[model samples]
Target chain A: MTTLQAPDTPFLALDVDRVDANIARLRQHLDLLGTPLRLHVKTAKSVDVAARAFGGGTGPITVSTLAEAEYFADAGWTDILYAVGLDPHKLPRAQALVERGVDLTMLLDSITQADALVQHCRTHGVTIPALIEIDCDGHRGGIRPDSADLIPIGRRLADAGCLRGVLDHAGESYFATTADDQRAAAGVERVTVLDAADRLRQADFACPVVSVGSTPTAHATAELTGVTEVRAGNFVFFDLVMAGIGVCRVADLALSVVVTVIGHHGNEGIFTDGGWMATSRDRGTAQQAVDQGYGLVADIDGVLIPDLLMVGASQEHGVLSIRPGSSRRLPHLPIGTRLRILPNHACATAAQHSRYLVHHGGSTDVVSQWPRHNGW
Target chain B: MTTLQAPDTPFLALDVDRVDANIARLRQHLDLLGTPLRLHVKTAKSVDVAARAFGGGTGPITVSTLAEAEYFADAGWTDILYAVGLDPHKLPRAQALVERGVDLTMLLDSITQADALVQHCRTHGVTIPALIEIDCDGHRGGIRPDSADLIPIGRRLADAGCLRGVLDHAGESYFATTADDQRAAAGVERVTVLDAADRLRQADFACPVVSVGSTPTAHATAELTGVTEVRAGNFVFFDLVMAGIGVCRVADLALSVVVTVIGHHGNEGIFTDGGWMATSRDRGTAQQAVDQGYGLVADIDGVLIPDLLMVGASQEHGVLSIRPGSSRRLPHLPIGTRLRILPNHACATAAQHSRYLVHHGGSTDVVSQWPRHNGW
Candidate 1:
């Protein structure tokens, strides 16, 4: 009903054609290395996009929350790797997913988690598989590859018949300013997980799968070698952060926040009916060279409004202005003019909305609605 | 079920006792000024909170989205104000609310919106009321008190029988560093709205109601002379941003994010199951004197964990560590240990969750779960 009607402003607009192109680009790159994508469903949690990403079929995917695992499982996605380090308290839900005939794999970097997983499986009468996380660049969670606890943690999982493989995510690679930096980060990620797998294998464990990726690293990495699959979520709808890192061009961003210009603020800028609540407070590009405040602005039809940016935001109000130091004049966008804001981080921005108003090609009208799964 | 079972970490926890106290504090202040509070439900967008906010009865409420307006209206709350600057595309839903017998008042600062409202009502046969926004402190939206267009804007709405009053929000007051500063901001806010309302009245427009507030100004204003009603939202669940501004103490914060220690990140910090995806990427306090990174860290019992802070966040991982330059040792929070993170901004952080795990006075165990209405 919201789709058939004029969409309430500040809704997420997803360009499906751009989604197809992005998927194909990643697929072609990974195909050359004979590595399949275990697409992470964290960004576009909608089963609609998940099906599209796999060429209209469900496939192996990575999830960050059990809610995602359960949602995807209900939608017929059987293989899921919960890539965040396992929290022992979530065992009941994880076991429930396993009981649903899902190949739900959890990730852990500690012996404490391995022991807890072992205990939970034994008590719940369910075998929930797990992957050991390797810290490729210390961007976030993971066990250092050289850590003495690695073997003991893997041994704990192996003894419990829950060890699936080893995985790594190059979180730091997102800050890469060049393809070379991304490739190097990817190389480190690959080597780190493979090394951990080798150590586990030498310790009489069959570490079958080797998973490693991040949106930037995935596109930059040249070879997979012993890796069975790669995982990524934010690549499907490229954003300004990816654009800032030189991973994708602004033209390649498929997702945007559609907002209506409610009023003008003097002659310098205008206010939109969208703000942090709609676009999210993810200033992912602030750390990059060219800080895209909130996001870059575009027309409803997806054409970039040169040098215009959403510079500030409150809860439900966005302030759009010409980029500081730019010679471009502020566009005369009257009240009711719909503007599309390309987000700084696609995953963060996409999470703000519960559904996507699907767009095809360059038309401003939404073709359909796709519900997004949110919350853990 | 989520309440009885050990919770999946990274859920929003709301303290009912704190909520009652916060509500009482604001109500007591407003009562002294003989002004009724038009509670802004934008902060706590749950009907349960809305009910508690009005002492278990529906009263006047302000909403930023039609979703909240519709949701609140369904719960038997009659008086409502859609506070965001009116987007013409949203007239259909607004009309639908009015059709349902909800006294919905929209906001506007431009003649464009006034003319559009007049045309929409004439075409659709629906009478919708509106308030002229006065720009106080140049914070966000609203028309200037002395602007020549103000009289015309009021005239258009007056001719259409849609004029209700004038409103202003001292948004800049949320950053006040002292009580005097907040008081000064509040005085400016009250005077601005009253001046604009007076101008409209002198022009023969019946500007009956005067609404003005922001959490800080509502608490600090010395008088509400000529102000019919005051509006404020964030005081219900005061956050670190409010604390930094000296509006309230940290003990007044009613909301916290409950997360589990998934793993340790060496001796310096621990990783939490919660992150920006759970807490939201609202670094509101970053602009304050003491930036509370993602948020302050607390134990499951709601006790502060001494100088500990959720210093950094990824999509699904939060890094909890002792504050930099502090001598306090980072306490050991082993895997499976639960912790609660007080947020930087309640409105932004609470929006990330779809429900609240209700608790009473220092208790970690949730008493019940209340659903939150989301999206436009």
Candidate 2:
């Protein structure tokens, strides 16, 4: 019943063919490493697309939220690694997932959390597998790989019967300025995880997985020695951020926001219904060299105008100004002109929508709809 | 069984008692104005909360999307205004809503849009009431109320037999420095609508309803003058942005994100699981004298910590640093610490979750859950 009947404005549209190509390329790229890819589900919320990613032989996946793990686990995605650091309060939910027969692996970075997990399993009568998060590049969460007593904490968890392996995300790879930077970061991540694994092995713990992944690093690194699997998301529908980082070309960026031109402020700017509310306030690549304000504004044909980015964004209204120093004013697009904007961060942007309007065969008409999840 | 029983580290939690109080205040405020308030359904997407909002008085409401209009209309809140600027491409959805006997008012700013709407309506055999947006201060959408062609466009729509009264949103008042600024902006909005109504009247057109609203202006301005109804939405659950602008107090902010301290970054900083993903990327009051990075981080009891504000936020991690220029580091909040954060913009932050964990009777334990809308 929900068809291509979209307002001339901000709605998420997926090109089925483009998505297929993106999935295939990622599959081919990861296949060469002789390691299985654990696709991260945080990037695309749609189980339909996630299922397509899963169909490519990466049944195991990483999840950012318990809601994602729950939703996908309900949809038959059994192997899930909750990449977010474990919260003691969520022990019940993690135990519930385990009770549901999900191979849910949680991440923890401290002894306090390890003790809490041990206590939760002791109290709840459920054993939840966990991976110790190691700091690869100090981007976000994780304990330093060589921290005193950290490996003993992993041994303590295994003694309590819940430890799984050691993992690292190499999140700093997102900041890599070039492929070489990505490769270097990837090597650092491999070393960090391998070192942590070695320490755990020295403590007589069977560390089966040494996880280190990110789309850029996954493509740049040739070897994953001492790691059992790789995990990377966002390769399915790349964004302007990935394009700017040289991880993928703009042509390979499959996702886009369909918006309508409601009105224009003459030469000053054009107004679209796609504001922070629709396109999301995720200016993921703003810290990079070329700041894509909200996103790179483009026409429906996927042609990047290079002179248009949402300059000023309010809650429900976006002001698309001509890129500074560019002599171009937008050709008087009428009140109904439809435009597509490529987002800066695919994960954050995609999380803002409820579903994907799948478009097939280059038509504006949406042939199918795929629902998305919002909470944990 | 969706018990947020000790929810994950960072997530949004709603206080239903506060929501009720907030709703009561809106009703009392509008009742004092001797005009009915068209509750903006954009603030609370839950149909259940929307039902609660309509419980006090009139059922007529304003919505940001046709999807919302349809959702609430199906729940029997039929008088809906798709408040965003209308696009001709969405004519079919408009037609469908009208055909189902939903009183949907569409907004238009330019005569170009009017022409297209007229053409679309004639082609589709659907009649939509047209509301001309009058710009009060140029914060966002609307034609300048004093524009020379105002009467001509109104008369054109009148001739076409689909014209409604002029509607003006004093959005600029939301950023007012003082009560006087809000009052003046409200007065200007009133004057703009009255002047436009007079122009239409002079043209022998019957302007049934001259509407004006914005929470700041609507709450402060006592006089309605020529206005028939007020459409103010965020008055239900004002946030830090509203508090910073002197419109509402922080205590009046009904929504707060409940988060957990995952780990400590150093001796001085505590890391929480709530990030931009949970609190939203809206730094609503940050541009004011005080910068609420993500929000004013609070304790479970809604007590603000003078030592900290969320200084930096990533997708799933928030760094709580000691306030800048402070003499000392914060007492590091250890892992598993539960914290509640007052949001900068309630609407944006609340939209990130599927369901709100509603706490009852000043209890830290959740008593109920309310579902929220994810998309149109």
Candidate 3:
């Protein structure tokens, strides 16, 4: 067995058992709703994790970038959906994937993109499947379900034989401070996307798939009556942000960065080699009730060091100190002491590393390595 | 010629001429003070940029990670300094670099680290050179120069034949709101590192190099009288943060992310493919007098898009909107229209990509592809 002590400091560590549990819980919840899971591969960006998500079969996975679509497609997961709004320049790449017998679906929320994609398909004599992004919570890209522009956009895509479904992400669910608030936001997400699909079908457009999710909404939504698929990525490694949203407990976080204590400052602060580069600058928990500064500091065994928070971070250094209003004295960790830090957002933090050091069943032993893809 | 329209959307573009001019201006300023510029390679982790910084000769460069040191060492940059404080677990990697005939110097700020190094050297019979970090500003690491602890730490390292120099970084200079404040911080940095070096020499320890710099101080400092070396990394690519500090004009920024307009939001917001994944989450300019949101919007020709800022970012989407109080209407950028965005911090933004699309002067033609090293 490979131990954590063997690798160099400041590398991402993944607990396989926690990951398995997190995935199982989400799968079970979605399965009970009769909605198939179209797992987003953006969070882990690793084939090993995606393989497990596929459950030993060819997958219907979603991707944020075409690079990820290419990676997972090459790995035999041919049914892929590129979730971000489509840019016309990427059509050639999308065409190449389609030519390879991969069922790659693109996303768009505007008539301008629809017309351009339609013209491209006409010029090339090849059809591309696309989804109309619906604005569920006003957090990001998407058209309002009731907007007068929504039906025309879908009609235009349907004329080009490219319209596939409707998708919405309740990203604002992450901002909800309580479980009730998250559930309410999830409720809003479901009705909004379903309304858009209903509007399209009423307009004589074929709307087959209705997709809605965000990690918070994925776990909080009470029903998936009209939704055919649920897409959530971050549950494979629940993070401090998920805990803040009341969706998962801190103990469920599977991802952390193993760092070494490099120095001490005046008995009030400890410095580690893990900084924004290793941990990322996503302060997702800042607006939560109990703000975990950068992340919650944990011992090597994954136990939270009480009251210790990464108060600040530079490029390559993290300042570990006692949280405000806490009377706990700083731990006297000597130089070279190894510790694991739970991140604010698993997706953001995991994107910083190229690979993960896997440990099985809460053990420090490194069971295997998993590589992740980055860049466009 | 490979133009901006040739590559996929959301890739890093580098203005080679601006990079050259920025480096030349800083080099000329330091050369007048008779201080050698040990360029920090952490900003643009590319051999192409480092070769230009080294003026076509072997480099005396500084790195924030050992991975960078190994990269440049393999590329023929022998004189290297790993600026982050030493962690014992990384010593073996450092030793491997030294054994391969690389002059790699480590950094430490505590006596505990000194004693550990002494024991490691005694056990292996190998001598490793190290620098004592001095705290010029209470921004991050290093012991205060005037503290009694400084002399003992230096003496212990000298006894182990590992004491090489003293180094400090006035990271607080970034918080300075005016040129006078930046100059004052730079002055303090110069004197503090010099004081530590003098104390070491008085205690019969050989303190050869005295290094200090931050991008703001590098351009604002009036003199480097007693300092042997000045290390500045971000000057190679000035950013919005430097512009906020009044060090460099916005025209001097050489790096930007080229992205395509994918959608429009309510006639006031435009969405692009570049997000925190492409631009990074370094909001260094947030505390400055003028807070450029995520980044300042620019055209493909590197011209500023007036009153436009990237107001918010998700994992793979950036919301470009008019800045608050700006009466300018949003530009009518159709889908597929390409634009560039100037980042807040060059170091943080540059670390997000695998390679740079280099363009000579402001030309859209691609001149070269420079690969960068990432991860530990």
Candidate 4:
């Protein structure tokens, strides 16, 4: 029963109960899908925060960088898929991990990298597993799902005895307007990974895992037909972006920065210590009908002051203005008024701080301080 | 010189020579204006970096947070202005710093904060200097430059004999498009502080210092007139944003992330490990031009790849796409080809890493590591 003492200033708060609920909700959905959840670690940055999503099991994990892979690996969470394509330079780190008995699978979308990785592995007297990245849609990385590239790369890796399976991240699902759009994106992800898997199988390659993920897609496409594992992140602490994408309710967002009102700019704006550097420059999914500039300003009870939004920000000050067409000067916020702000991107926002000051309402007990990882 | 050597990976590099050059340039300009340069520490989070900027003296610095104020103060660099507006919760931290003989000046913008600070100072038996923040042109914080509000706040503090001077940060000058625009912003900043000083003087209050700054305006406004001290942060490592505002040249940018090529998407694109998380999601000022997506992509030598840009970015993957009209497939970047990425916003970009890998071409060295300060 640890909690942060109420300070009249800005600090990041993690509601452990809300976090558990969010994790349960995501797990329930994945359970219904009968797909293993390979929780993505980029969102939380903290090994402890990420551990909550695992629910006390040695679940497989997805990482965006070697730094994350090393972090989780050091924390005894070894089954990791370095999701970003790898270069030869990472071979040494990968070698160190594998030699230490960690199950590490590198990702790649091109042959040049594959050949180089194979050569590096041969030279090092070690073999590393790899997943051939497939571009389900033009979101970010990957080779075309139906392209001739998949078979060659998949077979080449299999020939090297290091190919794992095919993977695709439906990043576009973050922009989905509705559950159906998310489901559609998820459906496409399944089709893309399964197609690549099928192509590899036809070429006599053993394709075991057809990985598909994106929080919105993972939840929406509960019954991904061919996907063996669902790799999703950001569901643990759903932000305004996730809520805007119809993936979760605002109340489901368990993490927020507790900032204090420091001053009032005339009668128009209230200034706080949370700025772009603290809250991050993420405007959230504001390009849609629901625009959250930076994030939604909320009270301690997690109730959104719909009329108040972080209208502007400097390095260390957030200038919040009342929503247009609304009257009242944002409740006079008053100097020393403590409030929680929901971030747009949980990952980027979380990265701004060194640790999370876990809080339980009305409690003075010191909870746990979760450390975060930084650098490459 | 501490070089963050991770083979050919995209990581931020700080060149001591170029940093010295940039510091020298800012010193020359500040000398021309006949004002002491209170180097802004937000841009370079390193105490060592600030020490280099202060090559002349004990170094009076401006910090964005109390954490930084504490860091530099503990590191023996005493004079600090917590540039951002202050909160009462941090009053204890300030008092502790003052107790340690740190010349700390807390910023106040409203009567409410002024009262609270006064109460805190009284309760703790600590006498701290207070600077009234005046809003020059609403670029960031401060009471309006010409408002009656400025006088009342100043007079109240002066009446209590706690007021030190009036301070203004012309942050809007960062957005200035031309020399005239910078000069105009500088004028606004100068007037904001001078006018507040005038109001205090007219009221028979001895307001000695009038502070105003922003690199663009600091360099452009030669005649400080009544301004006493200037504070500008980003001049330490000129960024792409500074270049876009005509404040410096791209060649003048001294910080960049050296990234490794992981894969290539045919002639369509090339992928690297330096994604938004590495280079930061800041599109810089060029966001108005072509939306450099993440930032301007460069080779290992810091040469901008002609017609090339970071077209897409995820957590750890940056997609380098040649402009649509350009037909050349980049000369085989190949896996492990090291490339340097010029940042969009140096402050945000620099803050992302734990320590800087100081470098000066082939001079591999690890001179110092600076911990980044987060939270209030």
Candidate 5:
């Protein structure tokens, strides 16, 4: 068996057992609600992880980049929703995937994009499936469900025979400090997207799919009544941000950067080879009740070291120190001691790496090596 | 000629003219001091950029990862110094590079590492060149010049016939708020590394290379009398962080992310496909006097868009808005309008991409495609 110490430092390690548990929990929760889970592949970006996510079948998935759509399509997963607002220039690339028999879906909120996609489809003699995004909480891209342009945008795509549905992401749910806030956000997300879908239907536009999700909202939502599918990526590998928001426990975090101790400053902190480049600069937990500096520092066995946090990071070095006033002395770990750092955002941290060392059943032995795809 | 509109949105664009000028400025400065410039390839990681930095030769270079060492070595660049503290387990890989007629140098700052390297070389009967990292500004790694362990560590490597030099990076220089502060930090960095080198020589150890640099210090240092080489990386493509430190002007930054407008949120802001995934979560300019939100937004021609900043970002969307109280009206660019974002840190931002779309002489045309190597 390949041990944890086999690979070099500053590589990503996936706790396969934890990942399976997390996936099972989400699947069970959504399965009870009768909502299909369109797993966001943008987080793991690995065929191995996707295999586990979909139970070894070509399941519906959501992607942030067209590159991801191409990659997963090559891996035999055909149903894809490119979740990012569509760029007109990338229509050709998306159409190519559609021509290959993949049920590729594009997203957009503006009439400009609707018109452009319609033009591109007409010019290319191809009909592409698309989603009109709705702004649930004004977190990011999307037209408001009550906006006058919603029907027009939907009509444009419907006229082109390309309107597939309407989707919304409660991305602001990550900032929720209480469970009530998250649950409320999830409720609004569901109602907002459903309302947009209803408006499309009232306008003679068949809105078949009504999608809504964010990691926090996916778990916090009490009802998925009108939602056809939930698209949550970070839940596959819950991070510190998810834990901070009460969405998941720290123990549920499945991804971490395995690094090596390199040096220490007297009474200040210990340093590691894993910097922002490894752990990522996503300070998603900075505004939470308890700020996780860069990440929560864990021992080689994936156990959190009490009171320790990576407070600072450079390009290739991380400053691991005890939280101020917690202890007077720093951990006197000898150089070369390996540690794992739980990230603030799994998607951002996972994107920093090209592959993952998968550990099964909580063993130190790596059971598999999973390669991840990157770039747009 | 391939126009700027050819590539998909959210790809990095390198202004070759700006890159050449940035490199020339650093080269000219270092040339006057009669110190060789061992360019740090950790920033660009592209052979094309390295070629420009080395003036089309296999010149001495420094890398932050062994993977970079291997990639550049395969490209015919023999001299390399892996700048990060060495991991004992990676000795075999370093030795393999050494065996391949590549003068690959490793770095270490502790006695534990010194002993490990000596043991590894003794066991394999292969000599590996190494540098003793000195703590110049208490920013990151290295032992103090006057520390008792300094000479002992040098003697340990010297006894093994693997000691090559002493090096230090004044990373704290980045925190300097004024020109005088930066100059003073650079002065201290030079003296600290030189003192360690002198001490090693006094102990009968021939410390040949005394390398010192950080982009800020490299530009601010008024003298390099005893320094053998200046190792500066980000100077090849100055970033917002460097500009905030007064090392370079905004116009000198060569790298940018070309994105397309995807949506607008009333008068609050506009959104683009570029986000933390494209610009990187390097909030480097946040601490500066003028906080550049996520990054400074620019027009298609690379000219700074007045009063605008990428105020926020999600995974796949950047919220571009006019800074608060500035005109109160965001630019009315329709969806699909292309824009460029200047990153805060070149090293962190460039690491997000696999290739660069090179625009020579300020032309909108993409003249070349430069591939970059990532992952350790």
Candidate 6:
């Protein structure tokens, strides 16, 4: 096998076996729910890594940027949903994708965006599939299903022959403290999007697709009678945030930053070469009951160190400290000691590097290097 | 006059004229202090952007990673210092740069690291210059200036013929709220590094380089009689954090993420196509008296929107809300209206993109595309 070390002090490492298991676990749940998975490729922005999640097939995928839509198309994946609300200036790139025989779908929640897409289609003589974003839990962007503004925007898309359906993400599901809470959030997400889809159909807009998901909600969902497809990205490499929400356990984390001990402060903390630049500034856990400062420390073989957490960071330095009130002695990790750090949010931390050093679950041997489509 | 805009909604925009003015402002201050500037390239990471600071001549620079050290070397720059604490695994990359005739200097603070560098030099018959980091104000990494451990660490490098002098960064100065507080921090920075150099000299070591800096201290230093160089990177593209520290004004910020209005919630806030992905999760201003949530909102012409701040963000969504209790009616930014969003930390924000969209001051015109050295 291709096995070697990076020689650099900090790099991202991915456990392929763990990745496969996480994907299989989520797929089994969706299989029972009778909904196919439209894997969001935003978390792992690599073609090779996403291929592992598909298990040797080009599954339907969701994207956060046009760059991913074009990149996956070039890599021979056909179906894609550009999930972020559309900006008018990006219609050209969306046009190029549709013209190239790719099943490109755009998303929007405003009449202005719908009008822009209609105008672009008329200007270029093309058809770009689109979906209306429905806000289920008031997390961020999306139109309310019960609002009077829904049918007008749907009428614009339906008249332009571009309406796909309705989709809603239960963003609050990420903070659900129990499996029952996640399940309730998932059910609310389905009802909200299905309500919008039913309203669009009542107005004679053929709403064919109904989508619902978020990492926590995807796994917690037990039924999907009206949902056509579930979309999720972070489940393929579960992070501390997922674990905090009770969706997954700490052992299921598939991604980590490999760093080396460089120095130490007197009774303050141990310093590692990895910093916010290696790990990201995504302190997603800061809002949780117990904030894993930046991330939890693990050994090179992916074993968690007891009560030790990354408490502070600068640009290129991380301070590892024992949890407060714990009498556990600091481990004798001298200079040049290699360790793995599990991140709080996989998407944020994974974006810090351009490639991933892949290994199997039982071995630290390098198996491959997967490049990411990191920037727009 | 290359003036066509990026079809993408969110991209990094840099003001070249503002960059020149910021660089010149610091140079003028350092000129009175009799110290040359060793421009730290970690912020912009773009050769074109750094070229603006040098004014067409190649000046000495400091880097945070070996990839930067190698990249700047290939671009024909000579003197470079890798400013982070060194890990022994990176010795080969450093040796390769030294072999390629780049004046690369490394930093470290312990005996184990010194012995490793010595072993590598002895095994390969090559000399690698290095600096002993001194801890001033109980910061992250570095030995105490008066500690007896300093002479032993310095003696290792002096015996191996690779001793350069001492360096200390007044990292705590970033929190200073007054010019006097910043100046006092700068004064302490100087005394600490020079004190370490004096200790090395007493041990019969010829300490040649004496370095001290941080963005706030570099601007606050009024005298540098014994200091040879001041290293500061964020000064070239000041952010809200520096503004909060009283080091610069809000108008002095030169980098921003230009985004288009995508959607909006009823009374919560306005939504943009940019988010934590575009503006990074660097909430550096949270510790300040006035927490600029993620960043402050600005118009396309770099004018501030009154009392508007980015209060919340997701992967591809930013919510612009009015500061609480402000009666300023929310601006009527319809869909497709483009605006600039200033960042909380320039380095973290700049790392989100692969290239910069360069323009000049007082004119909204694209002049160039400068690529950045983003990943390790």
User: What does candidate 3's lDDT look like per residue over A47-94, in tens digits?
Assistant: 898777667566788899999999887887788999999999999999
Model 3 stretches with alpha carbons more than 4 Å out: none
Q: What is the TM-score of each candidate against the true structure?
A: 0.98, 0.93, 0.98, 0.95, 0.98, 0.99
TM-scores of chain B alone in all candidate structures, in the order given: 0.98, 0.94, 0.98, 0.93, 0.98, 0.98
Q: If you assessed candidate 3 against the hidden native complex, which CAPRI class would it receive? A: high
List DockQ, one per candidate, in order.
Answer: 0.87, 0.58, 0.82, 0.65, 0.80, 0.85
> Where does model 6 exceed 4 Å of error?
A1-6, B1-5
DockQ for model 3?
A: 0.82
Q: Residue A59 of candidate 1: its Cα lDDT? A: 93
Predicted structure with the largest DockQ when compared to the true one? 1
Docking outcome class, model 6: high
Model 6 chain A worst lDDT window (10 residues) = A1-10
Looking at model 3, the pairs that clash are A2-A366
Off by over 4 Å in 5: none
On residues A211-290, what C-alpha lDDT tens digit does candidate 1 reach at each position? 99899999999989999999987889999999998889999999999999999889877999999999999998899899
- Supply candidate 2's per-residue lDDT for B220: 77
Contacts from the true interface found in each model, as a fraction, amount to 0.91, 0.64, 0.77, 0.72, 0.74, 0.83
Q: What is the C-alpha lDDT profile of model 5 across B169-191, one tens digit per residue?
A: 98889999788999999999999
Q: Can you list the residue pairs that collide in candidate 6?
A: none
Q: After TM-score superposition, what is the CA distance of residue B252 in candidate 3 from its true location, in Å?
A: 0.6
Number of clashing residue pairs, candidate 1: 0
Two-chain complex of model 5, DockQ on C-alpha atoms against the true structure: 0.80
**Residue-level error in angstroms, candidate 4, position B192:** 2.6
